[model samples]
Every structure is written in structure tokens, then in C-alpha cells.
Target chain A: MMHSLLVEGFGVQNWTYVLVGITFTLYIGIAIWARAGSTKEFYVAGGGVSPLANGMATAADWMSAASFISMAGIISFDGYDGAVYLMGWTGGYVLLALLLAPYLRKFGKFTVPDFIGDRYYSNTARLVGVICALIVSFTYVAGQMRGVGLVFSRFLEVDINTGVIIGMIIVLFYAVLGGMKGITYTQVAQYCVLIFAFMVPAIFISIQMTGNPIPQLGFGSQLADGSGTYLLDKLDGLSTDLGFNEYTEGSKSTIDIFAITLALMVGTAGLPHVIVRFFTVKRVRDARKSAGIALLLIVILYTTAPAVAVFARTNMIETVSNKPYANVPEWFKKWETTELIKFTDKNNDGLIQYVADESKNELFVDKDIMVLANPEIAKLPDWIIALVAAGALAAALSTAAGLLLVISASVSHDLIKKMINPKISEKGELIAARLSAVVAVCIAGYFGINPPGFVAATVALAFGLAAASFFPAIILGIFYKKMNKEGAIAGMVIGILLMLFYMTKFKFGWFGGGTKADWWFGISPEGFGTVAMIINFVVSIVIMKFTPETPKDVQEIVEKIRIPSGAGAATH
Target chain B: MSEKSNAKAYWKENIRYVLILLAIWFMVSFAAGILFKDELNTIRIGGFKLGFWFAQQGSMYVFVILIFVYVRLMNKLDKKYGYDA
Candidate 1:
């Protein structure tokens, strides 16, 4: 169906080159504009970040390369059921802003492990917390590296592995030099690049197709396929006619959807990098204010993602039908050579059906490349494609830097401060943090070149690990007065191990092959984190009930954090 | 430990507010999206189905509203307890 957008005499090769050049210069300029100073500045932007600036940075950090690249892919394939990711991600922010942000800020910690250690009054709990944080952070960062590789490979025609390394170097320079301070400012700039890149193509397509200025509302509105049916409703008719669930209807097990959504919410709150952003604020109230603002900015991108997916899919079907294969846009030939997109004229009609198989009813596009392909499928210009390439890079690099910082903080701040050298000077520990950042970048680059799955699919595992281990222990420690160190440690260890088994069992098909019939109440690996979380909560509560109470001193510590009072001023 | 700590009373009240708001949050998201979706679907606003909208856009808008509500409520809670720091 998409083979027809190519007409004789239209070529955008030159325009693509110019757009890519401008985006690169803009990012470097913005990075220099928001340079870092001092260890304090490097770590938390000197705790002087206005909620507005911080919001933009946090939005960039939170959205990541996956949201920009893979979310539309997911929506394009899964149709209306894909709204779960959209709702889960945006909804998770509500939990972050209200339930977790203020209390963690009041604890006044440099990292997530620091808060867990202090709250539980046990180094054992801290160690477990650090391990979980590392696993989640690394797994997610690896996906970002792969995205960076894809963007670089597509535009520059560099080796994919080389592109990954290039991304690592750029990220390492700023993240190592400036820490949170540098990353924050760069992320704000990155957000601007990404959002503009996303909206420009979307707006162009919407205007061409639906005469609508807003790409978001255009999703549910009628299509311009000249078919005179609502876009989703047409997709519904197309897919359902071929035996697919209607585009707006859901077909997945409701239990699985509920569980996966739960896991994602907890995971978002538990992520160390995102939570640490709150600690950058001066006052506890400011932390709450910052999260509110951060969430507002995040929604701007998150809400628009699903809409873009629907618009792109509807346009793709009409664009590709009944035309010669060579007549498809030059972008298809271009992307196909990269192996990012493929075409098969399913019905042997010399035209892509794109509709569905009567048996499966699934659209054939690779969800990972949906955002990049959407512009071309809609037959927009080449500059938008180049902008998408740059935006994908920005998304990948910003989150990679954020995750790498969290890993370094765990090593130098928690592990080194407590175990390696308890008496290490602050100056020395700070150096260790910088060195740790470099090491993490190298490792993430390695994983990026050799990725485990499509970018978003890979990061979803990180969310699972976070939900299973960190979320439960932290929430219990903060809210449940009876939860003690032993209970927390036991819960985290059990939660993480169980989640690992769940993930490996399916991904590797260990113990015979394929998905098991009995998956601890039939929860898919995608939703295992939610189940593990509930288990952790239950285990901690049951054990704490039988064990002795939290020590009086620990109780007092909890009381202190609960109050919104002084961390006082630091003269530095 | 100090005479003017004010923290103890401040914490007690804050906990109450969080509990109440969080309960509403869960009901809107989990309950409305999955648990009571069938019932809600029967009630549509305009061309959009209520249950689907809740799952797609409604709950998110509500979640945003809830946070701002939390912000105002927390501010009032802070000022009332004389712990606005």
C-alpha cells in the first residue's frame, strides 16, 4: 500500500543533510550554554534548578529514545490496546509526583540506595538496593545505546557498532564533566529538539491528510484516505475484516494488562535516576513542586505519542496500496538497505495489503521504526526524517547519561563510601564517581552494539526488575511503621531472584522451551514484575509482623523524614 | 526533641491526606480502567466510549488534576501545621 507515495521528480536527499547538521550544532550549543560547575553543581545542578527548567530536563530524561522511537511502533501494531503503555507511562508520573517524590526528598539523600540504607538501618539492605538499582539502570541504558546506534547508522551510514561508540563518547564527555548538572541542561535542549522534530512531521502529515493542525486529535478523527470513515474506525474495519480485533478494542488478557501497568507505575517511581532529580531541589516543598512541573512537561510528549502512532498507521495503509513496489518513497529503499524496514507483498497482488492476515489480523510494520517511518509513509519531506534521526539520538543519549550517573552514584557513593573506603574523602569519592561514569558508558556502549531486543522491549525488563525489588522495599520502609531491616532485605532478595527466573525462563525458554503453562498464576514475563512486587510487599509484612519491631532509633529516623524541615544551608 | 519541633503533628496530618488522595487515584486508574470498565463502557460521552477514554485519556487527565490537587492540598496542610518549610 505504501509503494505509491513515490512520484517521478521528487527527491529530498539534500534537505536531509542540512537538517541533520543544524540539529547537531544546536545540541552542542545548548550543552555549552548550561555548563556544570563544582562537585555540587555536577551532581544536582547546585540545587538551584527552577522547577520549570528542571521540568523540561526531567521531561527529556523521562521520555527517552524509546518513547520517541518505539512507542509509536507499539501503538501501530497493537492498535487501541497499545494505549496501555501510553496510559501507564503518563499515569506513572502521577504516582511519582504525589506518592514518592516529597517523602524521598525529605530524606535528603544523594541516591536511591542512600535513602534505602538510611531508612532500613542496614548495609545489607543497601547492598541489595544497589544491586537492583544497577541491574535496572544498566538494562535500560543498554537499550538507549542501541537507539543511538540506529540513528547514527541510518544518517551517517557509519557501522552500527561505531555509531554506538560515538554516542557513548558524546554522552561521557558531558555526563562525566558535569554530572547531573551537565546532563540536566543538555536534556532540556534535547527535549526541545526531540519535541520539535516529533511535532513538525506530525503536523505536516495531519495537514496533508486531515486538514487538522493538531496531530493528537487527528487520531480518532476521520481519515483522508477518501474512504470517509473515522481513522481508528477504518483501522478497526480493516483489521477486523481480516480477523483482527477492532482497532479500538482490546484482546489481551485483562489480568496481564492490569499487572503490566502496575509494574510500569512502580518501576517509574522506583527508578534511581528519576528519583534523584527530586533531591536536586533545595527545599522539600521544591521537590514536590519540581515533580509536578516535571510531570506536566513529560505529558506533553507522552500524550502525543499514541496519537502519532494512529495517524501514521492510517496514512500508511492508503499510501502503500496498489502501487508498483519501486514507486514507494525513496525513504523505504533507503531504510530497507539498513534492514530497519522490510516489505513483502503478502497477497501476491504486487501491492502491500498492510491490512492483516485473516488469521492473525496484525499489521506488518516493525514497531521500533514506526516514528522514523511515519513521516515517509505519510510522504512528508526528507528534513523531517533527518530531524527524527537526530531526535532519536537525543532521546537515546539523554537517558543513557541519566542512567550512567545513577550507576556511578551507586558504586562510588554507596559501595565505595560504605565498603571500599568508609573514611574516603569527599573529594576522592567524587573522583571515583567520575571514573565510574566512564566505565558505565563503555559497558553500555558494548550492550548497545549487541542489543538483546528492540529498544523499548529491552528497557521494559529494567522496569520489571525495579518494580520487583526496589519499589516494594522503599515503599514499605517509608509507609509501614513495622517493616524492619530483616524483612526489607529478605523481600528485596526474593523479589529480584524471582523476577530474574521469570525473565530468563521466557526469554531463553529455559527448562525445556517456550512459555510455561504455569507461570505463578499465568502472569506473562512482561507482567511478572507486578506479581513479584505484591509478593515482596506481602513477604515483608508477614515477616515484620512475626519479628521484633523496628528499633526505637529507626522509628525516630522515619519520623524525622516524614517532617518537611531543614537540611539547612551548605556554604559551598 | 526540641520544644518547637512541630514535625510530629505535621506528619500525622500529611499521612491522612496522602492516603485519601491515593485511594482516589487507584480507583480512577485501576478500578476504572480494568475492574469497572464494563460498567463504564455503557456510559459514553459524545462519540467516545467512557471506559476506553478512561483507559486512554481520561484517567491521565484526572491523574494530572490529582497531582495539582495534591500540590494545593499539601500546601494547605503545610501552612495549617506551621511546617511550610
Candidate 2:
């Protein structure tokens, strides 16, 4: 178990140990420094986090390991079709800012279920919200934990299960100790480390590719190798030459791309961890302001992703194409041992001839390795490689901590305090939240050891599920006064069940077997959430007509949440 | 204007701004990025096809601008309605 695995005969194990050790130590130190005493402080950081600080925390929480480690790899492989992620993840913030964040802030709640329960005047609505939150957040946290495991296994030479347990223990210490207060402050530090770590190597690669320091401009500038060709134009040509789709043109059907993008956007808006960040700020106005700032911070990394993808893709082609298998670079050899990048001489030519056709193509590379291996692929220094590892860990840990907090809050604050035992004291609720955090972390760690799907795919499913379940309920609750509790509860159940059915049928083929050819209107399972959301909306509207209106006080509360006026301190 | 009327007027203005901003949002992401991408791809901007730019990079820029526009418009409306924090 303690055997040393050499990466290129260099002790990456030592570098990873030092860097990860320092970051984990620093994070725990911050958690101890920022420990919360009261439930209010623990849940929403006493509702006094500055807009800028809160924005940074929100960005860190929102951008998970999928964004840091796998997104560039996805874009590299999917080409223009990958734009769905870029547009979907960022565009959802607009919905959050305009439709949800401000009103939720005015409601001044500890958790998203608090709003659902109070707004609908039904414990059923609250419990439904709590369940959806747990499903989405736990699914999300499991993916992040897997990301943590991946970084440790590759960098520290530890097994993936050990990495997951280590990540869980560190997350439990901070999450149980500081709660949201600790998580928020720690995330701000994480944001600084992650963005800087993400950008330095990107800048280096961009300059090496196009002679431009800015990755964004470098993506469009002429190749620095004196090819006199634009970077994307070169990439598109290389891609098409290999039978891959043009780098800038959509390959998937138009409707599928549209549906997937819509689902991710709506799901992002409905996410509990992201929504809870809005509650930490003091006022409705600050909530709006914080969302804009978060987007600004997130867009910096997001916009860089495509450029990095292009750089990684172009470099990969030049390095591997027409080269003998024996001459493959050290990085290529290293990755192959992990089986993330595979090569077989189908033609027995002893040369690496990569093509889009799987039958003839000998080189197969997993998309997730592209970002993590970018430094090595470019022959960058070891320190930069170590920094990338640290950054990936930070991104994964920050998101996992935030998600565990939400899962704990939904269980403790919403389910236990609100329903199971209404007379639970403040101290008792705090203990329950901490206890739930420990249990949720253990569950998430288990999932990390046995992840269901690819990191980005599982994360996408989390978003899709959230969109299908929570987005409609919360939106209708705020905007439509006549939507009764019965309608809301029924809509959630119908929406989530439809999504689960489609996903299991298509993605897993759980009940008998279903395939893409049998897809309804040719919509894939990833995009099915969009259709399910429409069903939720339609079902809610139709059911509202047949049911009685919401109570008068509930209508008054809805009106009160809309106006920014009378927003006082959040009650414990 | 009375407080209730002022609040009503402010709410109307807020809705108007949200509508206009949402229109821009819809155009950039759904329309230009998806429906009109092929048409716009005929024209290249810098190294990116116009449509490709909108899909990967351009739409995100527009979204950020849209949010700030909402913030600015809502802040003014809040001040008008005496709801500014």
C-alpha cells in the first residue's frame, strides 16, 4: 500500500505530498480560525459576508472539479458541441440573479427548503425540496470526492480509495467545525489559489502556441511557430484532416444541443449549494451584486477553458501524429500506464496514427486527462505540474465542503427541526447539522470509491435532476400566487420521476433496454431534463386551475418577498 | 406619489428592465449561439467564426453584462421606491 510509483522516474510523489500537505494544513487552519458559535453564524456566516467576498466564495463553490479537471478535456474531444457547457453553466447565473436570488435573500432563510415550506404553507413541499436537495447535492459531492481521489491517486501515488478517505476526513473536520462560516472563508482562499494555479500554466501554453500572453487573444492569434495560420483555423483543419468534426462547428443535432444547454442552465439556477451562497450576503441588493461578481470571476476561468482545449488538442496532434509508437513522449507513456490514454498498433506500423474512426485509430485518450496532463504534454516544469494538482484538489474540496454543508442543512434545519421535532432547540439543531455533515461525508466518500459514471457526466446528471425537480417549484412559488401546495408537490414528483425514468431507460437501460433510436423525438437522456421541466411547468399550471388558491397569508408573504423593503436580519 | 404608487411604478420598471435584459439574453445564447450560428459562421471574427464565438465565449460575456445591467437598473428603481439599502 505504501509502495512508491514513479512518474517519469521523477518523484512526483514528493511534490504532491508537499503541495497537498501545505494546502490541506492551511485550509484546516482557516477552518479552525473561522469556527461558528451560533446556528445563524454557522448557516449563513451571520448574514454579513461582503458582496465581493461572498462572490468569490460563490464562484469557488460553483466551479467544481468537473470544471477544473474535465471540462477542457470534454471540449477538446467534443469540439464546438462543448459550447453547451460554457453557455449553460454561466447563463444560469442570470436566472439566479433575476428570478431567484433576490427573493430568496429577502425571505432570509437558513436553507432552500425553508423557502419552499413557508411559501407553499405545506410540510410536504418542504420535505420534497429537502429530498431533491439531498439528491442533487450528494450526487454532486460524490463527483467532487472522486475528483479529489483522482488527483491524489495520480499525484501522490496513493490508491483512489485512500485518497477519498483522506479527502473525507479533511472535509469533515472543516465542515463540522466552521460550517458555512468556515467553508465560505476557506473557499475565498481556495478561489485565489485555484484561479492563479489555473491561469499560470494556461498563459504559458497560450504564449507558447500563439506568442500572445492572454489566452483569450492567443486563441485567435497567428500561431507562434510562424505557420501564419490562426490557432482555431489550424485546429479545425487538423481535426477535419483526421475525420473529426470541424473544431468550431456543431456536430450533434441542433435540438439536442439546445436541450442539454437549457437543462444545465436551469439546473444550475436550482442548485442548493449555489442558492445557499446567496443567503450569506446581507440584503437583496447585495445578493444581486454578488451574483454578478461571481459570474465575472467564473467567466475568467470559463472563457479560458476553450482556449486551453484548443492548445491541448493542437499540441497533442503534433506530438503524436505520424510518430512511431516507440517515440511517444514521456508524458504519453506515463498516462498510458494509468490507462487514461491507450494506444494499439492496429496496422502494426509501430506508429501512432490518430483518427476519428475508432476501427482504424490506434491512439485512444480519455478526455479527463487533458487538463491534468497539459503541463507535462507541453514539457512544462515540475512545479507547474504540482501547482495544477493542488489547484484541482482545491476546486474539488471547496465544492465538496459547500455541498456537504447544504446536505447537512437540508437534513438538520429543514427535515429534523421543521418536521421531525419542531421543538428542537437551537443547540440541538446545530448538533444535528454537524452530525449530518459527518454522515453525508461518509456516504459521499463511499460513492467516490464506487462512482456511478464519469465525473462530468454524473455532475451533469445532478444538474439535470435539480432542474427537473426544484427550478419549477421555486419559480412558481415566487411568481404565481395561485399555485397551490398540491400543484407544487405533484409537479415535483411527476417532474423528477419522468427525469429518473428517461435517464435510467436511456443512460443505464435499467428497465429492460432502451436506446438512442427509441429516444422520444430524438432527445438524448442528458437533454430529457428540458422536456421534463416543461412537463413540470405545464403540470403545475394545469393542476393550479383545478385546485384551490394558496392561502391569503401565503400570498401576502409572496408579495412581501418580492419587494426589497422590510428585509430584516435572518432569524435562527 | 404615495408609497404604494411609488412601489407599483418601481415594480413595473423593474419588470420592464428584466424583460428587456432577458430578450438580450435569449438572443445571444439561444438565437445567435444556436439558431443563427450557421448563418453567422459565414463571417469570421478574428480567428473565431462569429457563431462559434457567441456559443463558447460571446454568450458568456453578454450574460455578465446583462446581470450588471439588471443590478444598475434595479438599484435605481430601488432608490426611486425608497427601498435602497
Give the best candidate by lDDT.
Answer: 2
lDDT, candidate 1, A427-449, per-residue tens: 88779989999999999988998
TM accuracy, model 1: 0.93
User: What fraction of the native interface does candidate 1 get right in terms of contacts?
Assistant: 0.44
CA displacement after TM-score superposition, residue A320 of candidate 2 (Å)? 1.2
Candidate 1, which segments miss by more than 4 Å at Cα? A1-20, A29-37, A224-228, A321-323, A345-349, A358-364, A569-572, B1-9, B42-47
Off by over 4 Å in 2: A1-11
* CAPRI category for model 2: high
Instruction: Please state the CAPRI-style docking class of candidate 1.
Output: medium
Q: What is the DockQ of the complex in model 2?
A: 0.82
Checking candidate 2 for backbone clashes, the offending pairs are none
Write model 1 residue lDDT over B1-85, tens digit each, in one string: 5533566666667778778878877887788876777788787564345676677766777777778888888888878876675
Estimated TM-score per prediction? 0.93, 0.97
